[model samples]
Target: MKNVKWFAVDIDGTITLNGNGMVNLNALSKLRYLARLGYQVVFVTGRSSIEALALAIFGGTTQITIGENGGVISTAPNSHKILADIDKCRKGYEILRCELTHVNEKSVFPRMSEVVVDRTFNLDEGNRVFKEKGQDLILVDSNYAYHINETKINKGFGLDSLMKALDIGYDEIVSIGDSTTDIPMFNRTKYSITFESSTKEVRNTATRVVKGENGDGLINAIDWIMEQKSYCEII
Candidate 1:
């Protein structure tokens, strides 16, 4: 309980297992449980900060979020700060839009720190095109979409920033996620949990692999953490 005080959870494939882009009540309840237990649950996700903020407000009193795979940080519902340079993001996106044939305007979300879009073409080809346009930017594919993001930016970077701002430590946070994008956070934390249904890379990266996937998996992880912490305290 003393060492682990925060949960940096992934959104799409981790918490909302259904891929419906909405956190189910079951997931929300466990988040509330964490809050009640004096734990801060900051969502570290591929979803935009606005989307993450909405989920935070709906879930519990946890008002902070790291969204767009560590591109934006939101302490409140309506306000947030982007981590990436706006000029670089703009230039890369503009170049990519001109170069990539499958850049779907309808599927694209506005640039925050990353340009997100649904998978329409070969992601490998897309990444190649993006790199050709802007060598500084990289394309990351998660459970749902493709993201044009800075090379150095990732979930771990976002979580690290959040920890510094809140005066939390790396060992004090439990990073829970189920995507390739979640790998860096896994390395950043001493404690990382993923689900059975995730990719082999993700499963292997995590310290603990839950028997279930998505919300059920997350809830199970939370219970396990509580038991582990309790045992640690007793000892």
Candidate 2:
């Protein structure tokens, strides 16, 4: 890979083969292979940083993880950098809970900087409520659940923070994902890959949309990149 030294990947729909959160071992293996090739693989996800860290540890990738969709970053086992105000997210959640009775909290790993709720209510209605109440919070659908995050934070912000911390440039990374939440990351990177299962907006945001879905799609993406003479000059 030319100047690319890092692979930033989303976990849920991007690597998980099934909707029930079953990981695709094949994709995990492919990530491991990339790691062996000196490409640091970082998990940038909406899932809890702890959970993503665990995946990184067990999957034999880099231990760094960006969690809560740009609100939190885990650099070590017991250390995390909080990027967003969880209090504001909590406040937004409370407002939504009070206004939308059907908006129930989803049972998820403990979050450090965001609130996650089940995808049972209309997101536009929630956005309208936030707009009317002047809350600086936004709801994002991760395809696995709904996340209430700071209006100013996103995966791109998180990745930028990580890049700065690691002394990596923006152009030194490649991003992969399957949802609109990953669009910010896509915009920040020169090479972004999404799958056919992603919505048109997400596909349009990516530099390329690969065939297949989930882990199979991830492998296909790696293969496609390997075939690109511009990106695979040294490899």
Candidate 3:
């Protein structure tokens, strides 16, 4: 019942958005209020810093974010750190061949490492190849399957690193996420809440599931935690 001192949040579906790049102002206000209430908020997302940083601006300078499935953490611009550098995921010949050969009728297989940085996209060339293979290729700032690319990085590893850095116990924290990728956090956190909009697997593992979708669910969770503070506190 203590005030949720640590909040590990997801970005895409939880905060930033689904199809739009814009954010919900009410959510931002809620987050700011939580901070003033003494919660340490951290963004545990699969996005790369390039994409996630834009979203973090909504939290102002004090916000902390985990990107590239926890391969990167930036407490501030100059404070960027790689929590887990799973470079083995870096594109290689054998991996590319395997990825291409395993491609399904509805899936795009991209040699993401061979990706060409372009004006309009992060990995245009990679997406092109995936498309040529008759797969549905979408360029997300994150690869939830990054472990497929390299066994090193993933949402779980990132969450572990964030907890170590903050010197907070998992038992005192509440984590909220909405993806298969978020499973790692769900598995480890003391309390896990899945948004009503999450995938089936994510919901199945949740300790609690909120009613609203997207940031609305997150805001509800935060309010619930703050309400608990009237009974408990963690020092």
What's the best-to-worst order under TM-score?
A: 2, 1, 3
Q: Write the per-residue lDDT of candidate 2 for residues 2-93, one digit (tens) a residue.
A: 77788999998878976567899999999999899888999999999999999999899998999999889997878999999889999999
Separately for all candidates shown, the number of backbone clashes (residues 3 or more apart, or on different chains) is 0, 0, 3
lDDT of 1: 0.80
- What are the per-residue Cα lDDT tens digits for candidate 3 across 51-157? 56555575652367776666677776556776432333333323344554442211222222212121232344444554565442233333323222233456777
Query: In model 3, which runs have C-alpha deviations exceeding 4 angstroms?
Result: 84-87, 97-149, 231-235
Could you give the C-alpha RMSD of every candidate to the true structure, in order shown? 1.8, 1.7, 7.4
Model 1 C-alpha lDDT per residue in residues 3-89, reported as the tens digit of each score: 898888888867785777756568779888889888888888887877777788877748898988898899975678788875675
Return the lDDT, model 3, position 116: 15
Per-model TM-score versus the true fold: 0.92, 0.95, 0.72
The model with the greater lDDT, 1 or 2, is: 2
**In terms of TM-score, which candidate is stronger, 2 or 3?**
2
